[model samples]
Target: MDHALIEASLGELTAANSRELERKCEQIALSYIAQLVEPQFDVDSADFARDPRLICADRYWNLRFQAAPTLATAVDCAGWMAEHVVAAVQDPIREKWAMGYAFITRNSVESAAEIADATADVVAADDSACNKAYFAALYHAGKLRANFFYDELEIFLAASPLALAAGPHRESVLFTALRAFAAFGSRTTVHQHGCALLDQMWNSAERTFAATDVVLNGLAAGKDFDGRAQLLRDRSAEAVAAYPGRDILHFRLATGRWMCGEYDAAMADIDEALRLLPAIGWRVSHELLQGQYLARRDAIEAARAADRQARIDRDRVQSTEREVDRLAGEVRGTVLRAVELVTVFAAVIAFAVGSLNVSLNGNITLADRIWIVVTQGVGLLLFAFLILGGSWFIADRLARRSERRDRPED
Candidate 1:
């Protein structure tokens, strides 16, 4: 409501109570008590003798009447009654929370002290399950409401807090609206747990970044889990193949597959990397890598053979271009490796020349001879790797093949 209208209403409420107004206040209190408790019995009429809620609620209103001296105070008691009754009736998890509310508000002083004690005992002293639940609900209510606030603050920063206060107040009201709710009993606890997990979040980023994903098939928000994982695996494989020397890429790809929960494929990458371990020059491995593939034991081998063909649909799609690129990478890697080997040979030849005293060549010092050798070695080594040395690989392969053919069968 606008400020002026609200101001006028407040002025009317403070007027002295006449006989008519006092009777109205009594009616108002009775009406609220009926609405709160009668609904559960599914009766139009309240049986004061039979219903405990009606007994508690009615007594609560009378207690307010006895305590309140001013007419406005009586009206305020009527309001407080309405709040509790409505709380019980309107709750989604109604009946229970509402009944608790009514029972607690049955006496104001008792409730105030109960709240204070429960707040300290349940929160500080560690109370029973029920009291702790009240505290948990309170904490969740406050935290979730604050989370909601942090979200809206990004956009509607200009709006008053009341704009968003209506919602998220159903279960709680940033703990403020607990007065609107009815809290009944308090509990005393013995001990509390130390190491416990509360929940697992799909997105650690927390603010609408709901999940992790590799880009291609679908976002993490989509229902296509398999599709997202397939894309992630394919991208990882492509990356690994393109840079085979980065053997750690195998471990990384496996990690992504593991996240996808594709156990076999993840282990396949690791197993394959283990077989293709770097040469002695690399010196990386001192132990075994994780093999998730071996997780499928002999028992599963039977199941796999039976279902393997049927599981064709589960295989990740391999694009033609990606495969072709992988092959091209292999070709380039072979050429690179050969060039590296030739460069080593050239360094060895230079070393050998440095060790010799080349007196035959105009009595040149070893230093001058080494420099001459290095200058020629670089150019010839470059040629040996590919320009003139392409034939070397062909000859070597042929010689190996001839030797294999000539050997006796083992």
Candidate 2:
């Protein structure tokens, strides 16, 4: 029961269609029976009645072609089918997932729930294979939990003797793969939520086993739920006592500390895990957790930058407004002063020509005529300058207003 081997097999099963995966499962189980310890008891025809996989497969195959594959219809068919298979066989979890895959692809959450519920009970009853399937079912439940009628998934963390004896070295790998699958779904809004639960369940399971390098790395990176990080730290201490100079549990313990928001402790764990990870291919879970840590760090930095920019923009706007007000006030005073000067000049020119009767007679000297003419000419030029200056000021103001109106709001 190498968790890694089973994980690889499950990967094949997941990617394959229902029928194909089922066939592969049957072949593997049969091969294991053939090669492993020989059977002592007889498998009777009546015992076949107790064998549920055969019964389930027979029933589901018929249901597939008969109906339009509604959620209810799929469940009804798959439930009865899976029960019979598990009842007759010692471990039918893998076969059940294959059945679930069929129903899931057809959008039958009910059928998957039926099998998942059954698998949970087996896990509680101490079936090692059931534990694996329980996590798998949790993932399916998350993926297809929309229907209220579907049963809820319950994850059992206690160790079973059958499971402990089956694959001492491999369960972690299985845990890793299933967790990745569950996480893949949970990453999206529309997918499964069983990922975190599965991670928790496996973390509990890992505590009962001998600590390995891969397991330690996962713990150090905080791959499990928050509550379990402390447990991993304690477990890592045990690993150190049993296998001194090993980097496996030390890194995991550090990761647990990190996940618990102890950055300094996490850094220490990372340093140790890095020392050991090179011995084995770095675990995928550790890599993903590292990515998550980096992503959060980036998000925090971005938020700080945005806050700083907002303050700068606010100050700039206030300064610009004050400058505009000061310029507007100066322009207004200058315009009013110009109007008053033009009025005074007009009155003076009229008084000189009319009331004073200062005439430039044709028989008078040229210097007198030139002085009178120059005075009138200067008055005319000053009036024209005032008129053009006012027009230019109005035009410039309108142009600025138009530009502001055309600009996009922030």
Best by TM-score: 2
Give TM-scores for every candidate, taking all chains together and pairing residue i with residue i: 0.17, 0.28
RMSD of every prediction: 26.0, 18.0
**Per-residue C-alpha lDDT of model 1 across residues 68-111, encoded as one tens digit per residue:** 32222232332343344444332222222222233222232222
Q: Compute the lDDT for candidate 2.
A: 0.44
Q: Candidate 2's residue-wise lDDT over 318-397, tens digit each? A: 67866776677567667757766766677566646642454536565677767766777676667767765775687578
Alpha-carbon lDDT, every model: 0.37, 0.44
Model 1 TM: 0.17
Evaluate residue 145 in candidate 1 and report its C-alpha lDDT on the 0 to 100 scale: 25
Mark the regions of model 1 whose C-alpha exceeds 4 Å error after superposition. 1-38, 42-196, 199-410
Q: Write down the worst ten-residue block by lDDT for model 1.
A: 190-199
